[model samples]
Every structure is written in structure tokens, then in C-alpha cells.
Target: MALLVEVHVPLTPTPGLPPGEYPFPWIEQVEDFLVDLEEEGAAESCDEGTTFGDYFVFFLVGATEAGLLAASSRVAALKGVPAGSFALVTDTEAPEMGTGRRVGLPL
Candidate 1:
């Protein structure tokens, strides 16, 4: 019933913003969203993944498919979030699924 939501956020500097500005403000928004998810019993765990030079990845577990999609959409609508920002929805318990390959289309 729960799904894995993989969030990929770009860390590139936004034009017209101050130096060293965080390109994606949606990250905080997503964190807040996760809090709501927890309150609603839709989130089991959330973890910040290793950050590469240009982007960062985070994982969320125990989210309903609809909830994850809605949260991802909200993050994509936030200001200062780059176009590269996206979320991958995956069903880890689905039959015929590969070994660690549950990424869905970008959100």
C-alpha cells in the first residue's frame, strides 16, 4: 500500500538571487509536507540522501501513491525551485518489480 518517493532537487544557484542562495526552497516545503504526512499516518520514514555536487536526493517511505504525487506537485510549484527538481514514485511491493528499480516518471 505504501510507496517510495524519491525526490531529486537541483542545487544550482538561481539567477537574480543572492550569492550562495539555496536554489530550491521546496526542500523545506517538502520537509514540512513530510511532517504533515506523518501526522496523517501517511509517512513512515524520511531520510536525506547523499548530496552530489549539483543535486541532492532524498527518500520517503510509507507514503500512499496519491499522497506522494500530491506532495511532489506542491514542491514543484514552489518559488525558487529549479526546473530540474523532480520526484520519482515507486511501488516497492509490486509484483514483477526489479531489484531496486522502482522509479516512476518524473513528477
Candidate 2:
């Protein structure tokens, strides 16, 4: 049962850095953080193969709240990342358990 975790990371442009300068340093930092999670047993694997618009999406599998917190803390320390960026974790195997309400009644 693998979980689909969406980590929304807020990015900031650094001064003196050109638009195409490419912030590889900060990106490497994010990768390291994800790798640590995998090594710590908090995550099964971290997939770095997705791109979300301008920002990259790191798919963190088998994540917990504690693990999320640790990752967020490390990411927050980076210069180009903001403080409020979050890691959204959800079980991919779990179905939507919400109650369905009809919008319109039948005549």
C-alpha cells in the first residue's frame, strides 16, 4: 500500500541570480532531505521524476506527520524556500469516504 504525498514547496527568487541562473544548490538540498527520510525508515522511497510547473514535485512514499515535519524544517532552512511550505500526505490506496449529497432533487 503506497501513499501519494504532495509536498507543496514555496519558492523565492534570489537576488543577483538571473532568471535562468538555476538554483541547483537549493534543489540539491531538497533532494538530500528526501533521501534522509528514506534512510530513516520514515519513507519507503522518494521519487524525483516529476515536474510541477516551475517548481518540482517530490513524491514521498510512506510518510508520517513526524517525517513531514522533519523534512519541512530542513527545507525551510534553505535560502530560496519559504517558511510556510508544507508536505501533504495521503494514502493512495484509501478511497474517498465522504458522504455524497445530491445537488438537485428529482421532480
TM-scores, all models, native as reference: 0.59, 0.57
| Candidate 2 positional error at 3, Å | 2.5
Q: Could you tell me the TM-score of candidate 2?
A: 0.57
Top candidate (TM-score) = 1
- State the lDDT of candidate 1 residue by residue for 1-36, as single tens digits: 557766667776567767777665556765676677
- Checking candidate 1 for backbone clashes, the offending pairs are none
Total backbone collisions, model 1: 0
* Backbone clashes in model 2: 0
Query: Which stretches in model 2 have alpha-carbon errors above 4 Å?
Result: 18-20, 77-80, 93-107
- In angstroms, give how far residue 26 of model 2 lies from its true place: 1.1
